[model samples]
Target: MFYFSICFMFFIILFLMSFFLFILSIIFLMMDMVYFFEWELVSLNSSSIVMTFLFDWISLLFMSFVLLISSVVIYYSKEYMSEDFNINRFIMLVLMFVFSMMLLIISPNLISILLGWDGLGLVSYCLVIYFQNVKSYNAGMLTALSNRIGDIALLLAIAWMLNYGSWNYIFYLEISKNHMEMMIIGGLVMLAAMTKSAQIPFSAWLPAAMAAPTPVSALVHSSTLVTAGVYLLIRFNFLLVDSILGKILLLISGLTMFMAGLGANYEFDLKKIIALSTLSQLGLMMSILSMGFLKLALFHLLTHALFKALLFMCAGSIIHNMKNNQDIRLMGNLVTQMPLTSSCFNLANLALCGMPFLAGFYSKDLILEIVMLSYMNLFSFFLYFFSTGLTVCYSFRLIYYTLSGNYMGSSFHLMSDESWVMLSGKFVLLFMSIIGGSLLSWMIFPISTMICLPFYLKMLTLMVCIVGGVMGYTISLVSLMYFNKTLNLYKMSFFLGLMWFMPLISTVGILNPFLFLGNFVFKSFDQGWSEYFGGQVLYKNLKFNSLMMQMFQFNNLKIYLMSLVLWLIILISLLMI
Candidate 1:
């Protein structure tokens, strides 16, 4: 326990240092100076592979938030994971994850970025499977492999960068602007980002990754793994700006946001609902980024990290008190039993729903406003607004099921906010959920946004929030009366509940075909034909020759004499010819 406390304190100190650095970075940004440091690692044929770090307000600010949240998570885990024998290992894995994220944040060179990218995937896989359960194992594999696709795409991008002299893509962005090679690199980078960010087809892994420990989920879904993709695109936005691929990315991200928002409404698991929300927010970031709003995306990313992490921590507290029951269906009247947690949970949910003055409002509402102002096709326009409404829809639904309904759990359970460590973390984040967005907006975007729109367009987001919230609450009330009645929308519910069957498509439709092909190859080519022809036939021939030699041993001299005479006769015939 003392050792864990020491580790927690160490992280807290690191986070403080990062916060100071972030302030310094802002000062530097204002002064028009950005820091760049590089060390040459290898040079071949005029192309140099260098490790490079870039320090600007964006990277520093993001790093500060990541460290801050990570510190809180570690502190929270000291209590959350106290009973687990391997708590130290879990903490260390999280620390490594943080370090990897920092590496990724600072790296300007694509070659060096791979170090952090691969490290994230590797460490996240370890964290996801920390419980050593079958579910965790499967989730870890899905998460790892899904992210691996992005890793490969990044590697391909790096390979393509070899066409230029240096792997330092930052230096080359302007020089190679709109070049075919650069476009290819941009396309590959977007694909990589998609995999990491859980956009569309790769989105299945995010919800499934809820099998990880709740703390890990909080870190991963909030600030670290899923956000890596958005950050990557943000870094590469110079090249992606106004590119055809960027428009395509916009469409896909919009769809992903809508998909995840709908999925959350049907999800039952507490953590999964939050996970899907993270996915939805990720889509928002990606879509906004695709519109070339890099700073806006970064702003939302930071704020989302704050409230989402807080939400997860609150969820963790509830799950702990509930003895690991995650189904919101079985959770009710938590407000009466665990007032503090319930309050924090409701606050975070409101933040998630983009309530007027909360953290989410500063970013999410602004994002919606920006989307409405942008020139977009009908499909994208509809997706953006509908997805925004769905955020409110699922959030209110979640609030009703968990906080306001009748007590649905066993009466023997005792719930309270006695854990100081956990409460401390939640309180810190709760304060942030209220003010983090407003604070960050002031710090990151000093100039306020200027929008020229009609009154209805301005009130569009507020109206959607109201309608969605009312519908969600009314549906939750209706659910109780019809609790035992068969839901006619079971098919639709099942589809949305299962993330539009993406997990099924990824695991069954996508993976099963390859699995079947592998089995067929192994059976027909490897075990059947290859085995019989190569190994079996060779063995049979060798055995036959050996047996024949054994039969004609020294004891069988007549056979040896006959073979010699036959050879001699063939030699004489050749000589005469």
Candidate 2:
């Protein structure tokens, strides 16, 4: 126990160190931005590799959110992680994940960005499997493999770009601006980005990933992994602006938005529902960014990091209090008991549902504004239209399931609200949910008014908000009524889960046939070996004859020796060649 305490303390110390490093990185980013904005290329040597400037307006905004979300997640994990569940390993992986995400955000070069990208995915896999249990291990493995497929595409893009002596992000930016290589490497990279972001047909692993602990889910879905895809898109937005493939990306993002949003509406698992919700929101952000509404997408990303992390952690707390019962149906009237958690989750839900004056409202409204202005694109129209309704449905469902149902849990003891360490983090996010938008709305939506939105536009947004809320409320009432009498609506809403399984279905033949053939071949070989060696007859004879047994044993030794000699010869020849 004392040794475990020492290990745990070591993790705490590491977490603090990471926190300090993050602060320092943010300061450096500010300095980097100033240099990038004002400095000329002629002023510096070409080959120098010192602390370099990487900031653009997008990177600067992304860095701020990355730092802020990572800090909050670390703080929340300090108390939420179970001491017995390899807490030290969890903290180390968390710190590594944060550091990698920071590197990704400010990465000046594609090579550097890929480094961070691959590293973040790898560390997240570790976090997912921190429990060292079978289910977690399998989930982590699957998630890692899927992300690795995306990683390979990124590597291919880097290789293609480097073939032209372009190793930096500026190559792609220049290509976008100049219309160079519009269809090849650019398209490949976009597909890679989609896979990483959990876009349609590739989103199955994300829900499965909820087998991880809630903190890990929060980290994965909130800012690090899912956002990596969106960041890649934004980073290459210049190249994507007028490209045909880029237009297709807009369509794909829109489809993913509706599919994942609706998928979340009927999930009973707390973490899976949130995971799908994150994917859906990411799709919205991606769709906006794909249409060149960069700042609006980023603003949504920032607000999302704040509230989504809060939701996941509070869900973690609720799960902890229930001794890991993650079924939302089993959790009821928990808000009155877990006030701190309830407050944070409710605040996040408000933001998610785009309720009035919440951070989600301002950020999400910005995206809607962009979509409205560009309503000429039929894809955009359907994307935003379906997304608005689906977002409200799932957002309300997530809130209603966990805290609004009649109490149905077994006799469960309630601990105090959450630990001070955890509550401190939750309060920060809750505060952000309430005030972060209005305070930074101008900075967040730089294309709009710096201080306040135009009067007419604000009024337009207010009308949308009020109408959307009423529609959401009505849908929830109808859902409740239907659920009380039947389960059709619930089952219909969840049909998208079938789409999520497409990948596994496509690969089933490849895997199943080979496995079946291998099993048959191996069984055949075993029977052939046994029969030819007369193993059963030999065993019966050996039981009655000692001489026969000695002869058979000698023959076995001779066969083994010959096999070893043959293997050595083959190995030697291979080595020589």
Candidate 3:
């Protein structure tokens, strides 16, 4: 009961704070006003401890977006979770999640960031497991363990910073530029960011995290948990660009982008499709951030937040109307029933595919053009464009499955766009999805970027997107008659569909060997050799010795003779010594 009121309180406070922060962010942008707060905690000997908060245009703008999205997400969750008995607890968890994100958003010190970092991981685990199912439990563990790696990395970075006698990483960009310790710290931070953002070798948890409620998915995937890594890297971009770690991140992020898009095409779950799309966009942000486009990365990050949130909210609406059925195979002609949601979904999908003048287009198109103009190797160039096509491929494939077919859901389903609370949450982001990109592009870049490329090169994005759309339409046209042929190619399809077995490689693939080793150790040491030779062996020897002594004390002739002989032998041995 109180949770609902508190949620409303948070929504109002965050919305108001977001408004003022955006204005202040613009002021900081225009007037170059950077504010830092350092509170002295204590003085010990010659050193002092302080709590630091940094307020600059970058942190402020990010905070504004985080708060704004969180407000809408909380609003959306009201209708979505209303039926659940644990709705109050859900609201509380969501509030904690939002608070942790704000803490992470404004901190310049690694020590303070770790508090928020660990909070995000812990709160997200709670939210992921809120369903009280085995699947949710496993997903929660995976999410927690995967994020723990980044938390440890941040801890190491903080420990490593001790050499410099300060935790304020903002102040060391120039001093630690070329130092060896800084290189190690940079690598650790990159590893942290990669794990948090679900980059290659650590991406299995993102889609699996779809076990969470749809509203949590919208919040976590869009603007909170997944983006934390990208934001961390954005803060450390100066150390990443042109470094070895940056080059590696560029390649890995490109691969992650490709893999996510490919996996989404083969996915059947509606929510997971969106999850993979989020992963792909995260890869985009990370790739460009590695390429030294921090502003472009932030621009896309903000714009992506708007549409992706809207996308997931629409997804939540459809999922609810379908009676919690998330399989797209059961969802068709949804556009005819839930017109508003379908429209929002289609708009978000188009924005994701980088439709011209939409949110994704402004950032995605610019990123592609910049990649085209940058002198890069052929491999990186192919990855950039091909991944873009894959994004559209999945987007169109999803569109065809969900919106274009005859009604395939249950006949009893009362599918409609009647949830005003949910719709209200969506419309704000929907408006932003259309207008936020252009506005951000204007505000983020006071001076527009200048680029010139050949016409064919400039049109490459449209060309690939067209090809992908056609492919998607054709792929979705595969009727039941063609199901047998896919089985023939099941091996290849399974590999591609399952993220190239990275999930296997990340999950059971990693745990099995360690589990086997642990079993072996338990058997041989705790129950086998050590069991036989340890305490039992010592007790057995002592018992046998005591029994032999008892035998000698028996007062029989043979026993006395044996004891006398043994005693004579011992005395002679002592005399010789």
Pick the TM-score winner.
1
What is the alpha-carbon lDDT for the whole of candidate 3?
Answer: 0.90
Model 2 lDDT on a 0 to 1 scale: 0.72
* lDDT tens digits, residue span 42-158, model 1: 999998666789988788888988888888888888888888887778878998999999999999989778999999999989988888999999889888888989999999999
Candidate with better lDDT, 1 vs 2? 1
Tens-digit lDDT track for model 2 on 541-568?
A: 7777987566657768777787789999
Backbone clash total, candidate 3: 0
Tens digit of per-residue lDDT, candidate 3, span 1-577: 6656766777788889998999999999999989999988998997888889999999999889888999988888877888888887888898899889889988999999999999999999999999999999989988888888888898999999999978888999867778888889889999999998999999999998999999899999888999999999898888887789889999999999999989998889999999999999999999999999999999999999999999999999988988899999888888889999999999999999999999999999999999999978899899898989999988988888899888787778788888898898899899999999999889988797688999999999999988988887787777433877778877877888899898788778875676688899999999889868898888999999999888767778987887799999999999999
TM-score, cand. 3 vs. native:
0.89
Better of 1 and 3 by lDDT: 3
- Number of backbone collisions per candidate: 0, 1, 0
**1 or 3, greater by TM-score:** 1
Q: Which pairs clash in model 1? A: none
State the lDDT at 371 in candidate 3: 94
